[model samples]
Target chain A: MTRRLSLFNLTSLIFGFAFLYLPILLLVVYSFNASRLVTVWGGFSTQWYGALFRNEALMEAAWVTLRIALLSATLATVLGTLAALALTRYGRFFGRTLFTGMVYAPMVMPEVITGLSLLLFFVAIGLDRGFWTIALAHTTLTMCFVTVVVQSRLMTFDRSLEEAAMDLGAPPLRTFFAVTLPLIAPSIVAGFLLAFTLSLDDLVIASFNTGPGATTLPIKIYSQVRLGLSPEVNAASAILIGIVTLGVVVATLLTKRSAARARRDGH
Target chain B: MAERSLTRKLTASLVPALPYLWLGVFFLVPFLIVLKISLSDPAVAQPPYKPVFDWSDIAGFFSQLDLDNFETLVGDDLYLSATLSSIRIATISTILLLLVGFPVAYAMARAPERHRPLLVALVILPFWTSFLIRIYAWIAILKPEGLLNQGLMALGAISEPLTILNTEWAVYIGIVYAYLPFMVLPLYAALEKMDDTLLEAALDLGSPPWRSFWTITVPLAMPGIIAGSLLCFIPAVGEFVIPDLLGGSETLMIGRQLWSEFFSNRDWPLASAVAILLLIILVVPIVIYRDVEARRLETES
Candidate 1:
């Protein structure tokens, strides 16, 4: 099985990557197409890119989406890191089962259910559905994802560094900030990036919890898409894909560098 | 020293408490509210549901709540059919994902160690992209004048464009496309960890490759298979965006129905009932996932 690629293996890899990649590649290529028709190519042009910038409402939604992503990702990172610490560090506590369930449930729960339930909760509590509500919803949903990422890092985390720092008389908080945080910082950043992209990508939760004046980029693009295919949406999606790709690349490089550093230092 | 110990204890307990409180309020409490709303009657007022749970008149609030929404769900065949259809669609899509995902995962697992990471990253890169955009990409490809049809036509494979968009076939393709990563990642993780010697041992005993693969590789990969299938199947059951965007208006998935119930029809109580039922249906699989995760963590730790 580990030998040279058989026909089955070669075909699978070729078709798999093509299937995974071709659609998005086509979408990106079509963004620069001169034709208004989404699929057909008259020639290469960046008209849609120009139109994307000129579209005021879409721009506003994009701005809103970015701010929400930033705020919620930062918040989710902190909370999720704490939750990871709780799960990994704390041995056993009251309601541990329930705590674990709550953290994991949101990760796999249906968006519609999560969205609908949150909207209901907001209504029941008399909280207005708007920017803050959407942020809260995104935080709740994305924090679990953050927890999963950070928890994996924490599980494999070396404890001797913190212990050595403690043995040298550093306080717990100081040790965490000075030692543990630096070592796990890469994962924290990774978790933040994950949360950020997820928040940016979410449409369902935002849709349910949204109110007047809180349209996100996905919502804007969705409304336009429903009307018909347009090069404008292709341009917008291309830009979004570009941002996420850049973030992922940066995070991957950071993690790789840190891993290499750890290997060097370990020996 | 005593004061320091007290502060340390306070923070020690406090760390777990913060996230506990956050999830308890936002995650657990909201679910309770959904359950309560589902049992209540729908109204035309603000919030669109009745029996708002007046704390002072708790008795009255409890009395007002009934199984009306659940009754509605039972009496009407739409909800039942939608739920059944969603299950059917999710089941088939999970199988298709396995069919498409297994070979790629196996190939990736068998790839050179240095190249495996890059392959994994490529698989995950698209997953990190927007779900809506991915489905939107399919809309362009599957449409009559879209890429697939045009490519086929140009190749002289067909004289006329095939209509695949806005059909169940499109939904299947979209699910397989989107969830391939979910399926592959876990399977790769399992398969990659497998010991090569066991398969070799089987073959050394004169068993054929296919026989050894079925008996050795498949059983060893059971955990991954289960994990991957549950990962894809559970969420696929309650999927909203894929069905709404890719499937036609006639698509009867519960997620789409719930969206319409809550958004277009404004039947908040009924939507709550739908959500409750969906949660109930998925409870078994979710619990299984949690059990598997707990065991995995236990073993890892």
Candidate 2:
């Protein structure tokens, strides 16, 4: 019986890993293929990568995407951290449940609904639908993620450190910056990266909010795929995969190192 | 001490009040706009920007809310079938993910502690890639002269290439492929925390292996299963990219329907109505989850 269970587990492990990795592996391989047809395995060439660089519109979209991601991620992290701190530090108050629910609603709400509502809201407010609108929508969604990550970290935090700083006559703001912020720094960093990745990968919200001139990379990729994909897209996708994988690894390592340092500090 | 007390009072009063104001302005305001628009009449070329509070407009609004949009939805057999098809596709995909994810999660849970991180990384690596690109790659695999068919033909399994692309099967494959990790991670978290001794105890009580698994393991993992199912099902219902990219022209889902209603028909009222219905469907599960979580917290406390 144990042997059968082990065999079942082994099969699932192998199939599951292969299922996840194979398509990505194929995509990476085909990015270097000289042939335009994705199935044909021609000799390796970096020509598509060069083509991707020379595509001016794609470059512009990529730049806009990066700008939006960075700005929105920073804003979302700040607001989310404040929200999380407020929720965790204070006991229940009037409208606390409603506020918590509102904060989380965007996280699980269908992106289509969120995008449509925000689009309508922009139209109603007489705001031109453009990059700033897209950033606002992204921040709304990304802040929820940041709140979740930061809130989890806050839950594990010991409260005495803040009290000690106050007992030593440090101001509340100074105590926050010096003691509390340093303790939750890893979570803050994690939340920022998560927000950045989410903003970068967003297509639905950006699609609804964007004007003609404010195309994001995911929107560009979506339109390109719809118009029938080219190998240049494969090359572009390969670059994105590499950049994100590297970012995740580096962030993970940084957080681990910071956690180790925090343990050593014994505070 | 006086200054400290003053500071604490100030912080207590000011800090918690701020987030509520922020959420009210941004989050709740937009949602309220959606609800207002959903109730507004379509005859008005552009509905009023601010919600109309006049008693006559309010009465007319409620009176005109005669399910015109919903009647249009139900009158069309296509939309009805599409919703059902979407639910079926989502359910199947979720089940497949569970079947495939369970073993991998179990292996990870049972693996040497040192190797656990590596396994978890493998599970998450695909998630970091572009979702569109991942779905697009399936086209290469499922196309008529594609890799899968070609490989199968070469192996003498069949003479004719199978028609796999642009079908319900393709949609299922795409969804399961995309969401399998979501299922695995939560299940792994649950399984890893499980006490193996419970299983051993069941075995020592003369229970068979399957019996022990059903009695001990499955119940212990119910939270993970419920969470994973909700994660997979909700997105699958609203999924636009997968069905669009993989299922092609034949796949009629609510998401694609909503897109067409907005972009093609330009019927904002109908689109808003559809969005409201979708939101209604989602709210039930979300409320249930919150209730369950709150109950669990209360019990734990």
Candidate 3:
């Protein structure tokens, strides 16, 4: 019976993995196809990748996306770390629950609502919809992710270490820089990377706020897909997938190494 | 010295309140604007700005509200049906995600400790890519002359190519593909923390393995199940991408309808009304998540 159950489990694993990844694998394969038809198997070529480079609008949109992601992710990390520090350290204060809820609300709220509400707010404030608006919206949304990551890290942290630094007559700011920051550095980096990816991949919020000239890569690809599918978009997607995968792997390796070092140093 | 200590305490208390002020100005205020906009009449094109405090506009606002937008919503068979369709699609997709994600999460949980990281990475790999790219890939697979149909045709499985793209099935596939990792991660977390002793206890009691899983494993994993369901369902309901990409012109989900009402029709009031209604539906799950988290916190404390 146990053997049968193990067999069933393996089958389930294969089927599940295949179901999740097959479509993506097919997409990557067809990016190199010589024929326009996705399945024709007319010899592989790098024509699509070449075509992707030649597309001016796609390149421009990619530049816009990179700028927005960098700006928003940086701002979100700083603000979110502060908020997380405040929430985790100072418990049971007035409106503490409300503060946490507001911070988290943006993450769960539908992008449509977030986008629409922000758009309306911009109009009300007489701020024109454009790249700045997009950045602001992205910052608000990504901050929640940063907060969650940082908060989880803060939860497991020892508070006595900071108190020890204070007992040594160190100023609070100096103690934070000399002690707390180093301890939570991994979580901060992870939060930043997560925010960066979210900002880069965002489409719905960007769509609602972006002006004609401020089109991001996702919006550019969306408009193109709406008109028709092209292998150039496929090539672009494949390239993005490659870059992101490399970045995540590096981040994970760094985190694991730091953790291992921490464990060793403890001994 | 005492004054300095009091000042430090005051600063510490004020520090947390600062983030809430930022949230209030940006997040909460925008939602308030949406609520105000929904109250105004769309008949008046480019309506003048009425201060939220104006008593005269308040009466006019609520009096004119007349449920016209909502009545129009319910009266329009198309909108009503589309809302129901959105719910149904989201429900089915959430169930599909759980079915596919559960065993994969189980494998990740049960794997030798050294191999678990790689398995977890695999589950999150697709998530790192752009959501649009993954959904766009599905178009390549499901289009009539797409890969799936072409392969089946070549294999003599069908006489002619099957039309899979631009259908409801395609939407389901896209949703399940997009959200599977969300289900997997939480379930993995839950299953990883699960006590092996419970299953051992059940086995010692002469329960079969399958029966033990159904009775012992699933109940303990209910929190993860609920979390994953909400994670999948909430976003799926307001999903603009999958239905737009896969469902074609015939599929009129609420998100698309809301988009059209705002962008295509330029009916901001009506669109805001639709958005507000969607927010109302979402509140149930939002509240549930809050209550669950609060309960967990209390229990831990």
Candidate 4:
């Protein structure tokens, strides 16, 4: 009750971290293994890393994935910020329930369903199933996450600043830009990174919506994996993990810095 | 001044309208398209799906809309069982996740204030990485000569490598492992905000630690448990990568079934129908979550 470090609590903390991190650490280590056998250790080597580069299809998919992620994450952040504002700021509006449902439905809906439904939408509208369509699909899939993240920050936000700005004769839009946006910017950034990761890590939705030459990294890895496990995949996964871990570090740092700054600002 | 006020009002209305229209066309409309496609017949045409409505003749359009795909769902044991089995697997996975996640979350909540952030960050870091990559890591760990089996054999736990790779157990492990972050985050958020004084009072009343835990901790953490459970369970039901990569051919999940129906079998209509059914099944939890969120926001505002 006094919050001393109990043995059971320490055990839980350590084991939980181990369970979460071990498989990943093992994968990273074995990516350098020279063994053709996945589980065996034939000593450390960078040979698989070399092989990963030599694979053209996988590289192309990676390129496609990066582009889609960049475009979609940016678009989703902007739209999600707007949607978050709509949910938080607009007290009531026409079709608010329907709007709210649409925003949240995709979050829980299975990838297969969202992918299938969107693919059909694309077909009906005569939009080609390629990079553009995948980008759009990713945007729709991710904006909900962005909205949830930003809206949480927005909900607890003090409206007095905005009101005070208006009281000082600033227009509503200008006040939003000059005051409110800066306050919630960190969460918006967190939302962007989240959307980017979701887009990059996507397999099922992109698989459904992808056409020839638009294969994403996950789709490429999945196809190869279905064929069989190889060291190249391990290498690819290691690189992916490294990049994303870097991104998450940046996001966490940003969130912490802003939160600290906000505390100072509050004080 | 009146004209400026009108402009400000228009901007206010327009900002919200942007997301509304986007979701309408992209999100909601696609659902309608899926519904229509589900009622149509599969074809060898470019789109591979016949239009449910033949607009050339209104009567023909109505007639073309058939229950054949929906009927196939009822008639086929595979689809029915796939849905049921997916629900069962997801439920069990949620329970396991809660068991593993609750302790970690509680510990994090009870951790020294200086160490809490780092601990929470460690839990979330894995989630930022590619899900496919995480699942791929298991193949190395679960294979016959893989790390887990080899480690067990080395410890004299068993003379042979356990057959865990490409099994339902592996899927369960993968789900819990992957979703552990989702489960822990919400739980931590709840437990961290808990009043330690409540526990102290319970203990002072001569209740044992475990007894106080049941009365104070568990009850207080109920919101977190339910929230974490739904967050993990809902998505796990529709999981594709885990069941596909980890579970063998014998594993029958709706996600896998839907994949094969669309990609392998070339049955777009049925795939759409399968997706529709999954959506319907998930509607209950989604609606409840939406209402809870709105109500929470209402109170916050």
Clashes of each: 0, 0, 0, 0
DockQ of predicted candidate 4: 0.76
- Mind giving the per-residue lDDT tens digits that candidate 2 earns over B163-244? 9889989999999998888899989988988998999888888999999888888898888788778878888887888998
Q: Supply DockQ values for each candidate.
A: 0.74, 0.53, 0.53, 0.76
> Scoring only chain A, what TM-score does candidate 1 earn?
0.96
Candidate 3, B174: how far from true, in Å? 0.9
| TM-score for each candidate, following the candidate numbering | 0.98, 0.93, 0.93, 0.96
Give the number of the best model, judged by TM-score.
Answer: 1
Candidate 3: give the clashing pairs.
none
- Fraction of true interface contacts that also occur in model 3: 0.56
Per-residue accuracy of model 1 over B1-301 as CA lDDT, tens digit each? 9998999989878878888899999999999999898988888898787856777998888888899889999999999999999999999999999999999999888887878899999999998999999999999999999999999999999999999988999999999999999999989989999998998888889999999989989998888899899999999999988888889887889999999998899999999999999999999999998888777777776
Candidate 1, A1-267: lDDT as tens digits: 336777888789999999999999999999999999888989999988999899999999999999999999999999999999999888898888889989999998989999998999998888988899999999999999989888988888779888999999998889989998987888888889889988999999999999989999888988888888989999999988998898788878978888898899972
Off by over 4 Å in 2: A1-7, B1-14, B43-66, B293-301
Deviation in Å, model 1, residue A217 alpha carbon: 0.5
CAPRI-style grade of the A/B interface in model 4: medium
- Enumerate residue pairs that collide in model 1: none
| Candidate 3 ranges with C-alpha deviation above 4 Å | A1-5, B1-14, B43-66, B296-301
**lDDT of each residue in B245-285, candidate 4, tens digit only:** 99988889998899999999889999989998888888888
Task: Please write out the lDDT profile of model 4 over residues A1-267, one tens digit for every residue.
Answer: 345779999999889999999999999999999999888899999999998899898888889999999999999999999999999888888998898888988998889999998998998988889999999999998999999999999988888999999999898899999999998988898899899999999999999999888989998898888887789999999988888788788777777887798798872
Interface RMSD of 2: 3.3
Q: How far out, in Å, is residue B108 in model 4?
A: 0.8
Q: For residue A260, what is the lDDT in candidate 1?
A: 93
Candidate 3 C-alpha error for residue B176, in Å: 0.8
Write down the worst ten-residue block by lDDT for model 3 chain B.
B44-53
